[model samples]
Target: MNSTKGSMINEKKGRIGCVKWHGDLMDTRTFSNAGQDLYVRVNETILAQYAKSSGSLTKKAKLAISIVSVLLFFLVVFLVYWLAKRKSKGKERPDKFVSRVLTGSTYFEKSTADLDDENTINSSELPFFNLSTIYVATNNFSASNKLGTGGFGSVYKGVFSNGKEIAVKRLSKHSGQGIEEFKNEVVLIAKLQHRNLVRILGCCVQDEEKMLIYEYVPNKSLDYFIFNETNRALLDWTRRIFRGDQNEANTNRVVGTYGYMSPEYAMEGLFSVKSDVYSFGILLLEIISGRKNTGYYNETYPDSNLVGHVWNLWGEDNALKIVDSSLVDSFHFNQVARCIQIALLCVQEDPTERPTMSAVLVMLSNDAALPQPGKPPFLVKKSGTIEDNSINYVTCTIVSTR
Candidate 1:
């Protein structure tokens, strides 16, 4: 019985050993699978992190490029502006340069007797009048002989020794025009020989004295008759008689009559033939309304100047109401209306919009359709200051009536 019991114990031990070996094999297989799964997960995580890093780098590079492009654009703009301003400053005025040349030479300082020599002064183009002759003719510039005054100087009625009627323009000592402007005027007027333009007879440039001799017109300037209440009646005849009629003087100084000056000339010191057209338009309006542009104040429309007042009246189809009261039944309505339209076209703020003188003459004579005018430069009065918003700061010179 002891032998049988020992054999059963051995058998039980063998079974236990077999069970332990099987269990060890199962654990080894599970551990190998778990390790493989862990490696796969780590690889996936590394790839994702790498992709994220690459995307962030691309965004940063794009942002940096955008900032650089913006900076370059502003830099180019600033450089261009600075260069243009420098160029403008470098340009010198022609008149100023001419003045320097004249004053720097001793030839201009010669006496009248020396200047009379044929080789001394160029008298072939324009007649050079003797200072003594002009003095006697103008009665030594007597105030009684004074016909009018202009931005240049005073005009005096002079009768030459030969009984020729002439008008003398005496340059003021403090006149805005320098010697160069005087020379320019002489040269410009000499070349032009239009009947409408004042004819130049001679000139005198002796020492500090400078004068111009012109053919005398029996009637005074158009302003004299047009501005006067009673004298305005004669304009109908005057207009019939003279339907056809006719500068950056210096950059350092502005040379023009106030109120009559064009916006380009008054504000930017720029002038052209178009500037003359602007003046003519203002004159036409003055003739039609019989009121000065500088001093016409309406109690009903206190804020409105002559241009603004006329524009308002024109827009409302009440243009005829702005006409001079003196006309009564004498003036033709169609003619007066046409004149107003032409005048408005001439006073356009943009110089290019204003018609040329030749074009103006055609408009006056013909019945061609006219373009509608845009808003004119309405002079605004602010805090005891006149603000012309269309332009930068300007210097104006008040001129005496001629």
Candidate 2:
């Protein structure tokens, strides 16, 4: 081949090399690090050329061989250089502005020690998890790790190097929340301070990947047992709390609302984690203030149920008024305030917004940020308008009784 022809081929090879280099970085499903292994072949190829005798070769033939070999040598050398750089980068961690997304298919240990010195998080600011760390924690977000799927995304179970459990909420590509909106939500969620609410441990937003990290609620979201014959028998609302396992017996009776019954159970014979959360919320409020919700009616707030009265007080910044007067002087106001906010969260009208029993436990244990509670269910006012809440009812009755 002539020099012009040979040069064109090399140029073409260089362009191909460039594509392979960056293409792997951008779309990694097919990425493979075999460059180092191929580097030694260059030496072998060069040495083999000498073994071919030049006794029968003319001067022009010799020149052509040398030119071709030189071009090939440069091309491989440039490839090696590019590959080496990329290979080294595998060990590096991404910056605030992430650029790559990697996928791995390996996991057996519940969790392993693989991360950037503990997510490189400030430990005080909004935590940012490396995509790699999240993958390891959730076993690459395995299907088995999935707890449930919601409108916004899917939730998966995870564990850390210390065997600490966590929940990962991976948002879908079409979730409609862009990077900016997600960032804003993260910031707002971080500012909240409570235990019952979902605690944000960290988050990952790399390239097209977006996920939120939370402490795993082992017992699970809400109580689905008040309906189960066995569970219903095992627990009474007065003693047993919401543990969303399954079922509720006695489909033949009207177990009237104790004010602790969630709306869904009351109206639709439906129950879920959130529905039970509503029931728990009422119990929580009653316990904190030493007030009985079943017959709660104050002259100052005659038109409101216990849930609404507290919500109104909360809006008026006077929720502490609902605290048990007997213990007010002996308790920490901040702690009590946090509990009130958490109770409100549990009692939220929308079952979807209510925290699960596991979340309630987290709220009681961790110092996670708390969101402002919305109006509770069955909120009534002097104007005669009523705002209903998600409910699941449980009454003092029997499985075969009417």
Q: TM-score: which candidate is best?
A: 1
* lDDT per residue as tens, model 2, 215-235: 665643223233233443444
Taking all chains together, the TM-score of candidate 2 against the true structure is: 0.34
Residue 303 displacement in candidate 1 (angstroms) = 3.8
CA lDDT scores, all candidates in order? 0.62, 0.57
Please write out the lDDT profile of model 1 over residues 1-402, one tens digit for every residue: 011111111132234211121111122233532332111112355567888999999999999999999999999999999999889666633433334434433222213332224312344344567777788888988899998765567779988766678888787889654444466555455444444455566577765677777767665555566667786776673362253330011111222545667887777789798887887777678777878776656676677778778888898998988787777566888888899999899889999999998999899899989988767775542224333323322222211122
Off by over 4 Å in 2: 1-118, 121-124, 177-185, 195-198, 224-234, 239-402
Worst 10 residues of 1 by lDDT: 1-10
For candidate 2, the per-residue lDDT at 1 reads: 9
